[model samples]
Target: MKQTQFKLICTLMAAVFTVSQAAAQTKEKQIFLSPPLIRSIYTADPSAHVFNGKIYIYPSHDIDTAVTDNGSGDHFAMRDYHILSLDHINGPVTDHGVALDIKNIPWAGRQLWAPDCAYKNGVYYLYFPVKDKQDVFRIGVATSKDPAGPFKAEPQPIEGSFSIDPAVYTDSDGQSYMYFGGIWGGQLQQWATGKYQPNGSKTDLQNDDAPALSCKVVRLSSDMKQFEGPVKDVIILDESGRPLLGKDHDRRFFEGPWMHKFKDKYYFTYSTGDTHYLAYATSDKPFGPFRYKGIFLKPVQGWTTHHSIVEFKGKWYLFYHDTEISGKTHLRNVKVTPLYHRSDGSIALIDPFKSK
Candidate 1:
């Protein structure tokens, strides 16, 4: 089916179900026109991929806070990941449960944040970041043969991953890059007793922040185990080539670095916090001089907005999460909507919560 026709059919099917008595049924018995994609539990930080004709989503699973909340200063305290897949755009979603868990990872603590997956040489690599036993953040790589599977994670994290939100981008020329980091704030440290520690200041977060962070992009080696080159900093630049993120620059990356290749351009996208919004930058080169484009999605109805974009079968969709159903910032549900691009290569802003 063509992309346009498939979307129209989906919209029509959703419309049909809302007019009937079936809408009043219990959560288990009800027929939903557009239900939350994963019904069993809250799933956030969606990373959608097209693998072997199926759309597979690898997202951080948000369980109830009672299980583990070690006072990381953040509400989200995820311990495992679930890989969800759909056969087609309008098909039912299947949850491939517990692809990777922290119990198996010796060095990992609680607080599993955003994760992304990439396929290379018959191996599916699940890249994720989690706080260590000491409450410090780091990124790790897990491997699986099947798209949805019991992925085996490396005992330790990637050599020097002291950040969050790991997003992997495999370019057309067979080169792969990993983009990861947090917002432009000083790295905060805390005691296991939920108290802030003093005399632990390392890097000051400001406009003059080091080039290594502020959204760094580095080339990955063929084995996908280590970095291959100098870590390139990706900050928005002014017309005269001066850095523009912390000062004057409207769209600085808070977290969630997603790299997409549209036509001949590289779209470097991320989410901004404090006042959240989904935004992007474009560049001709993968190791970018990425100029900041305007916001592609105004913040969803949530405290934090993290997303990944994928084009499946000629249709483009933005995979993001929101707290509409859960009513709490920590318990977020994933949302998907069709995305369009302007003729000039900029993406059109989308409201993910708009009614069908």
Candidate 2:
């Protein structure tokens, strides 16, 4: 759809949902919308799974801030894991307990981010990011026998250079693949937990094999113990093909690329426009010639969304963090929408909650 037509449709849906929002204002009443799912789980970077008849939400717990109460000192930006489940994703959600935590793992006391889970054989592996004292960030894998479990976490980290926002994908070949790294060069050495040194504390610490690209992905060993190769680079925004996005635009892009295969074709979704909006690209191969799809979503009720997408109950939902309170924390909200594909090959997201 053209931008103008898309705006009109969104505006109409917004008006229809405005009444529902007002009704939801009373504390005794609950809205049919997506979040404040876990009020205590001050959220961001969400990962969802359908296991054992429930939709489990594993999100980055906002455990730290500059202030004493909000800030978890040692684990900077602690992504302490909390669980919330919903019998019917279309309605009321339930809160479970703290499934995993950083303080409990004293050896690597650091902040964790974007915990994602997948069930293989009989084990549920949770993938997330953490920063050690030197501020060097890496992804960690923990296994649980059950979705809601006594998770056994290992002290050893997933060996990779400056890896964070760990996402594991099990390909058709029975090969496990992980995609991570951020706008700021993926392999950059941490000076102190999520904080990077300008000079990159360790030379060649980022990746022994990657040339100069910031983001990388690689095949995982069958056991998911290590990478088969160096962190492979993906989504290098060097040009826009449009002259406006010259060399300058390449440097001014946000990086977070997540992919899923549909009908043998790879659909890669990424964060861009300063992470306020999501755009997509697709390719026949896992690697590129990835043509830009277009904007997936823009500001909602004047809110910016970031880092979220999932397929649950045979439907696709986009989960992102909105800057509801300006400079304050970005509270994570899950917006369940039906993703439609256009004949022209563009992806359109219809906000179901707001439409009716």
Candidate 3:
């Protein structure tokens, strides 16, 4: 009887051990799968690039503030920039700390929105948009010797640049161009007459049947300091080649412009602001009359969606942000997932929360 009882006790202990081991394995997998890639702080508007063979993310540092959301984007309240980097796609991300701050910029008033970076002649140029003392948004450029930077801002905003969300794309042959502008709170509407109007329409063109406003693009000077020529409009067209109308909220360019080249074709992707989608358009040339492609990313658990597409180790990845962690639009978190391009060139649609 004693031996039988001892044997029963041993079996129970073994069963308990197995159950604990299985639970631990499940926890490990959950940690690896959960996102907000950098959990130390709130971040948004990820501008990802592969620099020196490492994936570097330049994102707006979102801060908790009492300011309320309004037509002029007063609630975003981003005051600094932080750079995040990773050695591998799913590997650990390192926050390199503040790259630039509002206090250091000589001409900035507030709200340093989405920014992009470009590398040329051994320098990294950080291009951002902020309201000036006159309360108009103007694009600005800052420089750093390191991709993970303690960057120095140019004393003035880019001479002819206006609006927001500056995305710089450098072509294979070596020239670089900047695509910028946004509607609604980004104040793209205020510049409708090609000049800043204090009483300009609070939103877009406002006529639903009218053609939507166009984002602006300009070739960068060799020094990467200023625009080389006049800023031109980047037109987005429908399947029939007609301009997408203002009523098409799901397809029109609202804010957050990103340009990436895949298979020698230029893909211009932007946020469909009110609709909360990441949509793309394709063009044969860098300066585009791009044909609108369907949505690539569905609405996330956030009111805003901004992203960047980059290739690392021959695999494509999409870096974007959502309000999943903080559950507040003004406080966001960045996330990443694999992005696949179909054989016919259309991007495979991504549902960010769908289980793999």
Candidate 4:
């Protein structure tokens, strides 16, 4: 065969190989688990929960990118809360209309990101991070008696550090714990929060009595607030250990810390590698001695993954955004999938070959 034919064959081979690998990764149990793939009703940060026999989704309203909402598409800055109900967790979705419009709340003009909902006592706490350039990115508390309602935002935000992405997890003991900030934190956490000192309890951050859970919970106190114990230093997301994100005393991986307690161990998931793909750490207690688990996911043919984990009702989902070819970083949509966990206890995202 001539050189040109050989080159053509080689080119064809490369394209085929690339396509095959891509198809296989997202197909088989290979790459990692990501979300919906086709985002019809969500954007940026996604907070999904099963409430009243349905999965209600709250997505980020902060349209930081250049894309225009145009009153349509994922670019729209969500001012009001849009509620969607799905009978099955892998949603065939229907928007139940705006459950909570900004006008329904006392504070009516802030952007929302990563809104979290938790049912406690007799009230539903719709915990969300508000986005305002002039305002400190903070978590807001909204409440309603009914799951679907004109949910009202509390006059006061979850006051502590400047924050965002409020993820509330009620422990097996009925302890309601909130995890967020960082990717939710915006610029505040970027340069400082990663430095670490062992023995610091998380409860040292605030004096609020909202529920008693520590804001940091770097070490779990019966109450989640800052620690009650004498820890070495205050809570910080340690990134000096992980080499993938970046290397500097300044660069750290403490963005989103969501944890789940297993038989005898606690699995803590946080974002570090580029504020994309998920990474995790495990500890005997909610506190330190956290062992690093390398990249739970990597950038795939689809979107960049963030704020992800296994959900209740036994299905797993990865929440993230994919940049459109039309525009790079601005337009993001949420995707979900049925996920599987590894026997070794590590999170294995589904590869293209196994996505089916």
Candidate 5:
């Protein structure tokens, strides 16, 4: 055979080998157990829960990348929330559509951030945050009979809400607790007055023992709208039993407050910005004296890290977000992976991974 013919035959053989290998790999992987659980739209701050025997997620819908500068998408300009669900971990993700939009919110300005949901009696309540007409951050609650709702927001914001990121937990005994708030020392005093006024708490710039930012929790009245008791500060301690504070501090509560009950422990978790990581601390009670264990998820490729922990069937999982799909810093997609706990009940560090 001529040299040209020999070279063509060699090229054809190489192409055949490559095609066969690609087919084999595709057959070996399934999407059910992979990362980036949803793909149709960019989502962030995933709060997963099982309701009526099915898995549902409440996530903030990120603003479109087209309007962003050079499509960098470096700002959180979200104006709505989307609820998603799955029949099983391996099943298809159902887009329940927009549950709530900021435009319909009479008093909201923009920037809808991390939200959560809880089922009480027959009502499904969505707890979320948005900037008021004045740009002050406030938390609010909306209700719908269906888990995936065209939820109706109460005409006014939760009377005393002034911070962001709301997570609701209902105890086994029927008592419901609402956990919310983050950063800024001065807001605590405003929080105490049931309004956002500057006269409330004072920010201490130098105090390491009591950082300006702390997670606050209050008992929710049966209505899920009113505070049942005084708002109390939840003190988070570092690994050495010291207080975590300051922007540069490893244990500082930058934002995102989530609570999960496992066995007999209540886990209080949050994201420490500046060095984004999903860190947690456990306490015997819902409100803590939580002793910081350590970081479960390392810093993600994005600037913020927020998550929700849930147990479905018998396996535990962490649901978070990253910019992998959009390639823009602010427009993120939700992802989840199996989470494991050590013998002592402390969680194991989870490294991020992608699914096929």
Candidate 6:
């Protein structure tokens, strides 16, 4: 071929390659309705709160590791927490580096899982779950004056706290309650007898016909660092007032508890771990004998489902995470989308994979 012809062919090929690269980059940056709220690093288990008119997210910082999957969550070897903020819905998110690290926590052993943040009387409390030296999961608290923090963890875990997923919800009457617990990898089953049994079953009660395991809730003290009373069972009942059985995986509470109030009714939302559904129940009080409503979020492209619901600027939003970025269970990313409530006082279900 002539030299001029060859040069023209090479130029066309370069242009095609450039276009293809740009397209792939664009696709990589986005999933589920929009790009990840924080893309600089992998994050999951978003605990979002609106503080001082801005949305603050406390998420588990996922690090890539070669830990073999042990079904009890040995593969999710997270070690730190990062705080993310956004001025508005669908706006740019600001990642505020490392808010808390395991190295700085004296009582923490490993695997810093889901976390939540609470602000009271000009102080911000960050609640997280990590394994203690004995390999038992316990909840801990850290404090920071700012919503985004270099928080200082207390020298010890909260007394009588165990398992994973610590979500603190403050009710309208100025009372704060923490809803926490998880099965399987979270080790909720091991603590069923009110004591940590090393040989406890990794999953729920083997009898499917029996009442399923329930999460725990306790009123927070004025200091916001400790519990005010004995932990109570957060029972989720079906429409017929029957306790959901262990076999009811689709509606049973597994992990990731978040409470929000809409129009004077309390909404208790949580993840059905093995089923991967973001289900919710409602009650008239904060510590609820909540009635199971239905699932609001269908499963995404990941194994675990965790989320937070918050209202910002008169609109509600759901902040959740999935493995869309890395396509691996332990490495996930956080994303946000608007949430809506139907006029009949039910939450509209969200299917993340549905087309725009």
lDDT of 3 at 276: 78
The local lDDT score (0 to 100) that residue 158 gets in candidate 1 is: 87
* Clashes by residue pair, model 3: none
Model 6 error, position 301 (Å): 0.4
lDDT tens digits by residue: candidate 4, 1-356: 24564455345434533453354344333433444434454455556676776766665543454553221123334566665556776657666566666555554345555576777677777776655444445556777787765587767554453455556777677766666655212333322344321222122122122111212442223433322343221133344532222231122343555666655667766554232446666666665546665566545433234555546676666555443322223345665665556777777754322343
Estimate the TM-score for candidate 3.
Answer: 0.89
Q: Write the per-residue lDDT of candidate 3 for residues 1-356, one digit (tens) a residue.
A: 24554455345434533453344344333322337898889999999999998999999999999985544568899899999999997789999999999999999998999999999999999999999988889999999999999999999999988999999999999999999998866778778778887665424334678888888899999999999988988899999999998889889999999999999999999998767789999999998899998999977765678989998888899999977667666788999999999999999998766453
- How many clashing residue pairs, candidate 5? 2
RMSD of each: 11.8, 10.4, 15.5, 12.4, 13.9, 12.6
Candidate 6 residue-wise lDDT, 1-356, digit = tens: 34564455445434533453344344444446645777689999998998988899999999989986445677789988889998888788899999999999998888999999999999999999999988999999999999999899999999889998988988878899999998867888888788887766424435588888999999999999999999989999998999998889889998999999999999999998767799999999988899999999987766778999998888899999877678766788999988999998899989776464
* Residues forming the 10-long window of minimal summed lDDT in candidate 6: 20-29
Q: What is the lDDT, from 0 to 100, of the residue 284 in candidate 6? A: 95
- Reference-based lDDT, residue 25, model 4: 43
For model 2, residues 294-337, the per-residue Cα lDDT tens digits are 56765342222345466676776666553232223334444344
lDDT score at residue 249, model 2, on the 0-100 scale = 22
Model 6 CA deviation exceeding 4 Å by range: 1-31
* Distance from true location, Cα of 64 in model 6, Å: 0.2
Off by over 4 Å in 5: 1-34, 65-74, 184-212, 354-356
Q: lDDT at 16 for candidate 6?
A: 38
User: 251, model 4: CA deviation in Å?
Assistant: 10
The window of 10 residues in a row where model 5 has the poorest summed lDDT is 65-74
Decoy 5 TM-score against native: 0.82
Candidate 3 wrong stretches, greater than 4 Å? 1-34
* Model 2 segments more than 4 A misplaced: 1-35, 67-76, 184-214, 236-253, 273-275, 300-304, 323-327, 349-356
**TM-score per candidate:** 0.81, 0.72, 0.89, 0.65, 0.82, 0.90
lDDT for 308 in candidate 3 is: 91
